[model samples]
Target: MAPSATAVPATAVPATGTLLRLATAGSVDDGKSTLVGRLLHDTKSVLSDQLAAVERVSRERGLTAADLALLTDGLRAEREQGITIDVAYRYFATARRSFVLADCPGHVQYTRNTVTGSSTADVVVLLVDARKGVLEQTRRHLAVTALLRVPHVVVAVNKIDLVDFSQEVFERVNAEVQQVARELGVEEATAIPVSALDGDNVAERSTRTSWYAGPTLLELLEEIPPSDDPAHEAFRMPVQLVIRPQGAARDEAHRDYRGYAGQVASGVVRLGDEVVVLPSGTRSTVTGIDLGERSLDEAFAPQSVTLRLADEVDISRGDVIAAAADAPVPTQDLEAVVCWLGDAPLRPGQRYLLKHGSRTVQTAVRTINGSLDLDDLHAVPSEALSLNDIGLVSLRLASPVPVEDYATSRRGGSFLLIDAHDGRTVAAGMVGATLPTAADAPTTPEGDEAWDI
Candidate 1:
């Protein structure tokens, strides 16, 4: 594959400075936290004071070696129980790139949290114990990674030291996971063997494993380019707020300061570019863009900026501004693949609040399609969805919303199902609506009816 404008060649990895978001997923006791700790520790990203605290805590527990997982187990309950309970994020940087690492819990019950972390991840580090090989939870993680459409996957066979760093053992485990990944339509993946506890083949190449020849975990992260650059894609921005200046004096600047504020959802917006206000079908031209007081000729995705249009079109929060020539059709009835995380079973006619980006709409489940059967890695017929169930469900929204296929635009294609009664998020939904056909392949309807899986 060729590198993009900002992507660097493999040899020039350290020369290109970019921010990468990564997440870790595996079964319980797979040492996800420890691997993360190793990355931070070996890279010299950890601070002296923080290291001292971890060491002190380890001594109090009378452990021979410091429990590196203590660095990420922030919650008191997690520390007491020696497990991660929520999504813990850590920021670190090396000479090559900056990173935002989400250390997600591995328990099957915490699968929802893993989805949240991997939803926007550029690379997912999936760990499997060498001794245990691939477990049910490991396959479940692979399924979620495939569903999220993560650009890169690293199947790190951890605890290799416990397995005597046997090359045959590593090969068997890697081959098994690779076969399952291919069955899920994941064509590309990287597998590495490491012992996060011993820091072997994690940040540094291990001498213990002379047979394996591949980039270390840290090297792989540095070399893989970011999934997508927002400027190179379709322009999109969901209006978060409307800025209409209200002041004590009605001056020239104050009277004409009508702008929309939002983070660039994707693509780039330049002055005089024609854009359409979605859901309302209002067309306008970008007259001005400002990052605080600085005037900008163009603004790209991820940058928060205020935009003033040439026409006084009626726009509000939740409205999507997209390129005039290409815009998604606003629809009220939609189908999505959702991972249910509520105590109450998801049934037809169940009402909930659907939050997509800045927009929130009242929604009800119209049909409970089928849940994915992890045993067979297939979607099976089901009438209802309980906790941690991944299924296809149709929704009837109160109003129209602009949506893109999950595979097309991550920012525009993901949503949350919030419980209206308790204001709690019960599910995370991906905008693609797919089903298995008789041909043994995932398919969507033709024309505008199709949404990618």
Candidate 2:
């Protein structure tokens, strides 16, 4: 297969600048699709053919004007129902910056889809209707965004035109949004009034609201710096494959070549840098870095490159290689906050497969601490977590695995629990504060007995 234009050499960095991954989230009918469409249209990212297609669809549906929301609502079911049901990813670029937008669903039923889309986003764009103010769904989105640790957030108060572009309405909504952000510990949030349907204050400053003065959403996005700190944190690479060219024709350099291949989960690794393989506590030095047919002097987080080691230490999938000083401690027990995704409630003693980065291992829920009450923002003691419920739980792994705190390192802290029988993801988990040993805490009858599944 031929490489696409977007594909670049492993060592090549764009001379112009960096790329940003952003996600759009909001409640149902909050104008998420329209906001995305307006941004693309006002930025001149949409082509004539696309515009014509939208117009044709609008006409067929007997709409008065071209429905810009059709641009992001790609699914036929979504178009027919006038609701976004799934996550739609769109890409567009300007001279100053490039963007990958994940348009997440706003419906409460699709929370899992939202989590999946925003998991890797650097910034989250949350849309709130100007007239409706902050709703339950708005708070839910904010909570999820904070939980995911998205570095930046932009709250676009959409449909300002319907509100007569009133400064008072905008101010009221903005104030409420600010209050919510403060409560959620989101320090970096920008609020802007926008008329998505009219394309105001999205890609360009709006003339309708002359009293307001703020950078356009596009302007703000282009100005924010891309996060590359993970590349410098600490070297971590989860081995995915062991590569060896085995053939009678292979000779010399090819015959001696043995590489551990996977994308760097975090930090920088250079040739000759000493590293340790986790779980086994094996140590080795990086002899070389290989990308396709070319050799590289170094590789950083997120870049997929094969590594040549100085020693022939046993390594395989599910094993992590990292800088010795920064290597995470291996453990069989873990505490975490899990968002249950399965139809069945999560019960203690129920075994599942845990997938962290490229590693997968058998795991079981040792205890269910409590479930979080979204409306009250508090934990309620519970024995099991039901579908769509978020709760704190403890897990015991069949084998030791290296992991870090979720707050400290997202790459190492986040994991997915999947059903071993069907390979379906059942929950999204974030490593929580570790619990003390039984001896550290005074024993009680309730705590002493094992939970019944």
Candidate 3:
């Protein structure tokens, strides 16, 4: 591999610097771990003792070069089986920015882990083997990335060296990937040619790829902006617990105190700010904000604080405090897109618990609109959804909930469906998205029939 390249000494990037969170996904044996390992090594993020251990293991296995994949496959099972079984996270920093990288498993059975890893990611890096081009797993991963609405996507065409660095092959694979990305409604995705086994185009560009004219993987990662600032959004905070000093052991000054405690989900809350309590439509003015034992005039998103209101409103856990003018409306009927993760098939009329924010309610699937076909990315009619299936469904809730459109607020718009029988997570859902109409569905030669699974 390009061992001749000089290594750059790792410098401590300040914690106050901008942070970027990214996740990696690809089919098994596509060299995802190798790509990650290459980046870590080229950037000098690995400790000397760790590299020595990997080198010793490589020699014992009768290899010429140290197996870089061993760097991220930390589990005992992963080392023995030479496969990733769970999500592996690594934190490192460059002078420009700090990073939190998640190397997710590639097996189909581990799709849930991929979802969990990518749920809050600002960018998702998907790899494709230059020889295999795009496989079914690639399409599946792309669909998941699009559904989650990750801010940025980068596709790395790995193992370009295997094809002798053919420009034609790279172009063909890039075209196919772009086409699939467009079908899935991904606004933009950049494809870069790289050889993860070597260090080419990963941390540093390779001379072998003369035809390619794109930024290297690390460069692109550092350039993409992080997720939007939470303070700029509308104010929202789900009440986790009601705080009221009780009992004789309490201090006399706090004996009559009543405050709502929760983490500010978005935007800012300040003293004298007019706020509304959801589902009850009760309005009150913020009188005080307390963090720990210290009182503050204002608190912003992601900060944990206790709020004292001007009025004695009857608020409880699962209730949301929001800005008075931009508060969400409560509704019982919801149209959503879901990725079914249960072992059992998902069918209409199935009863489950819907957990939205801090609240939970009984919900039923009124209709199974359709499933997205990976072959053509169309919404084909489906009576049921199997494990790892992405589909559109309508739900009827027992009580109204204040939810914003998923496009507007990820925290307020997303929810989870739980199996009531055994407390298993069945699906992840996004609200305020329309179900595909029958007219919008693609037709076969026989005309208007469901696509076969």
Candidate 4:
């Protein structure tokens, strides 16, 4: 399959199967690194030199077999500590499909890393030690996946070989995983038993598990749909830079050139499409879309393009250019779901810098409605939220921002909470805007006190 017609031809994109992004997440020591290494080794993605180094290192460590974890544990600190501290990315592919894998840390302290890795992942390969069916960390990871709305989840019951490859054990563990995944709004969850160390049922089917009838891990990877198609959705592009080349030496044809350069965040934009430069509400028609030296009739999400407008409009970085018919409303007040990443609890009236797309503004936590309990995926009325806590929050912005619901527009509806003082990322937010209805969020009365913000 050629690149989508709406996509820019100047870029080299996959043609057969759309690129898939996945992340490995599990409790510490759940063999996530090993599982990832097995996938690479079995698929012949690992180079001979790398495999030899792994072998030499394993022998030096007095291990009879190679330690595949060496392939992913890159940092010296991670290797010494035997825990992944940073998110490691790896690229590999089978003839059927291409993949970008994110090996996220499993510790509770690194929950933020998981968030960063899975934020853009198409599928989250959540590993579970067959011996330890579902840990608290598993619940937390599942909650994060739900909060982020990750498209697909594969529960790999790793280390099945350690349990004699028992079908009963696998079934018991699989049941628990499916129940939790479903409760957390994951529509489809697939659980498979595998031994990452032995390469059983990872890239290929394991003959030992005769009772199990399912697609191998590699087969599943090749099977899932890439994700939401940005080309078919509503058009949106947050201007990064306003280009004006007329000031410098230029060709006669480009002397009066002025354009807005930005990556298309969502949807498709075509020449002659009516667009509104947001916050300023300047309306104009798209005159041209250029990618380097090539002129394209249309462009879609994830592609960088310089757009020319028919009218001279006041536009700058942080301004959103959107389809006029589907323009978003700018508001000073925003209701959101926040995953607090800071060590300090998120308290009401606390000030921070809110970054939405390329726009940044002074903002404060006006109120914290409640926090979600990962154990049961329920809401707990709370005055403040601590690290790794998911909560409902309302924010007051110094300036109004044009935003949409996360379900409606993933790119426009997401934001980052940056600490004003030292520039640390405090939280990740998804715009809810409106309070949840009864059907969506069941009302549970707090003890003797009804607090309404």
Candidate 5:
């Protein structure tokens, strides 16, 4: 194989740049694994030993070229069956950006894996076979991306070589994808045509077709910005631990210090800022912020800092320290959208443990309002949610908790439902309905978006 026009050198050091979290989703045999492998290979991120192993295995199978898909499909079952059963994460870097890419399984049974991989992704790369066009699974993945509020969605029309690299097929598939994405309320949707197997328009432009003009897949990935900046959102922190040194072994300087330790989930915090504790509604002012041994005047989102408040309010592991003026109201009745992942059906009146942020509480499903219909992207009445079913439900919690709307804050609103009898995670839930209702309409951030199809 000839070197790609834009291939990076193996010896080139990875540049320090913005990190992008990306995930791949599509139907089986759509070349997701192959595409991931291509990116890793062209970027020179794969080790020489791994490449040699792939070459050896390809020869044993009597193949002409090394199987690049083997680079990411690390599971034994996946290698034998030629299907991705679990989410495989690969890290690689280019001159412009660093990436944490998750290659999600395409099989319908592994839709739960797709949801889990896409939950916190900055962007989701959805693949569609140029020959198959758009399928039911395509719509399902689009719905999942929309429901999780993934910032961006990229539709890769893989196997363009099989379709003769026709622009007509690419446009048709892209049009259908755009329509479905718009219906599902997915904001940033981009479509690009490429052959993942042949490395055409992947890391570099292919010379096979002179009719098409667009940035390569790698170029797009390097250009797309991260979904959100944690520092810009409202202040929220779930107390993970209370730092109180006791006993005579403690130093005098640390003897009187009492601090709340946790990662700042969103927004910023500074000394003298008024904060309120949830469940108890106690008010306090920040006196100091400690990051490890050093003290700072302020702290921002995603930073693990110990906070010293002026008041001696009763706070614990499950409590939340939020901005006083923007604190979320504590409530026991929660309206949410849940993606049922359990093998057993999810029915109303069933009890489970709800884990939100740093707190867990017993909760019962009060009602199953409706389940989403992937056909037309609408909510239809349903009595129970089966495996891989996405639905809207009402939950009754045993105690009050500070949960925000998922549309506004992803970290503050997302939660998991666990089976009490066993320790299995039954469902992944969001605090508000992801689909449109009587009161809400499908919407996205206001801006003129661009596409490189």
Candidate 6:
């Protein structure tokens, strides 16, 4: 039998069978946007009018060829400035895999935007210009990716066409990147040579790089496994609202209705499961689960459902409900790495709103440990964290709140610090291990005074 054009390879699986969430990082004008545009175009994800519009714009700008970068640089400011200022999300699919790509800005000032986009990503794609080799921005991006602990990393050596498709240049760049990856404990880094402007080795294999024997970028993305961590964690549901409808039909069927509504953050929750609500530590058994009008026997991670308890227990927003045996303990003091996003520096003793999961509470910076020096990937002791700076700090919450270590659980360990005055998000934080008390520590400071929250 002969193979058909639409026939799937023996190794190929359905694209919808798995979904991959990835983020792209690079220096400005390093072809991050162009690479994304090339991927989408080659995959036939762009509409005819969209392609025509891009071509027309390319002509208006007096370019000899279409500007593929315009596909994702959608903001008017981004277009005018020719630099990405905000995180832009693009979706596309191949026969073998579906993807949600977060195209992050490359400007150093937009580091906060990069963090926001890559926080939930399972994999990160770091693009480097073949001509420039590895620059300072490239190293900084790698440092951020390592700090975030993205499970997978791919280093794409872009603009191979401009380098005349030299294999030696590609090998040199790959070796340098590998060294950085090794230092960061990223063991599974893959480097591929490609030309995003010319559509080589992006979606389809490039014939120009005959010396390279690696999978194309798209092929690699499809073959990489999806993250199963969220499904394996203990069930967690942060109550977003209480479902209650009152009207003439609110008699009989609706009269005895009381349910906690929220989206499942992780794991599986089934009917009759014993759960504990944090802060209050109230215990209850799941009597029923409702998804809109239909009742479900079980609900898993990422599902939105309303749960009814066997006994009426006090539950409200900002409370996290989880399996009693696996519930996290609430704590008042939290140690974390924060990415300061505000123009003003983050000062110790400043009050802010700490938002985690569905819970939001008044919190203050107890101490500033240090800020990251991206160029050298070292922690420099600092009294305050500035805009676009990453730092370690201690947070003192007004009350205890459930939080898991970031190393153990990303979803439970992450939070956002919002300025109380204007309600603007000031920093992104990841909970770290708690510091030992004086009695539990090997040493104690002299003339120690209790720190103020």
Point to the candidate with the largest TM-score: 5
In candidate 2, position 11 carries an lDDT of 25
Q: Give candidate 5 regions above 4 Å deviation.
A: 2-15, 436-453
Off by over 4 Å in 3: 1-13, 434-453
- Write candidate 5's Cα lDDT for 199-313 as tens digits: 8989989887677788888999888877789999989999999999888746887788899999999999999999999978999999999998899999998999999999898
lDDT of 2 by residue, 1-453 (tens): 011122222123233457899999888898999888776766556666777788789899888677889989989999889998899887776668888899989888887888888889999999999989988878777877877788999999998999999999999999988887776667878988888887788887888899878898999999988865788788999999999888874678698788999989899999989999988999999999999999999999889999999999999988999998778999888888787888888887788999997888888788787775666555666778887677778888878889888888888999999999899999988886322121232211234234322
TM match of model 5 to true structure = 0.93
Residue 46 displacement (Å), model 4: 1.4
Candidate with the larger lDDT of 4 and 6? 4
- Local distance difference test scores for all models: 0.84, 0.82, 0.86, 0.84, 0.87, 0.83
lDDT of 6 by residue, 1-453 (tens): 011123232223335758899999978788999898887777767776787788899999999788889989999999898888899998888877788899999998888888888888988999999989777778777867776778899999999999999999999999988887776557778999999988888978888999999999999999999876586899999999987778885888799899899999999999999999998999999999999999999998899999999988888898998999979999999988787889899877778999999999988777777676655555666777788777778778888999999878889989999988899999988898321111122211122133344
Q: Higher lDDT: candidate 1 or 3? A: 3
Q: What is the lDDT of residue 340 in candidate 4?
A: 86
In candidate 6 the C-alpha lDDT for residue 387 amounts to: 83
lDDT of 4 at 195: 91
Report the C-alpha lDDT of model 4 over 158-264, residue by residue, as the tens digit: 99999999999999999999888777777888999999998888988889999889988889999998888777778999999998775455678887889999999
Highest lDDT model number: 5
TM-score of each: 0.92, 0.90, 0.92, 0.91, 0.93, 0.91
lDDT tens per residue, model 3, 189-263: 999999998888998988999998889999999899888988899999999999998787469898779999999
lDDT agreement of model 4 with the native: 0.84
Distance from true location, Cα of 170 in model 5, Å: 1.0
Q: List the residue pairs that clash in candidate 1.
A: none
For candidate 6, report its TM-score. 0.91
Give the per-residue lDDT digits (tens) of candidate 1, residues 1-453. 011122222233343389899999999999999898787777766666777687789899998676779889999999999998899998777788888899999998898899989988999999999999888888888888887888899989999999899999999999988988887777788999999988888888999999989999999999989887878888999999999877665488678778999999899999999999999989999999999989999999889999999988899999989998888888888888888888889887778899988899898787666778877777877778888888888888888899889888877888999999999999988887563321343332223322211
What would the C-alpha RMSD of candidate 5 be, to one decimal place? 7.2
Candidate 4 Cα deviation (angstroms), residue 285: 0.5
**How far out, in Å, is residue 251 in model 2?**
2.7
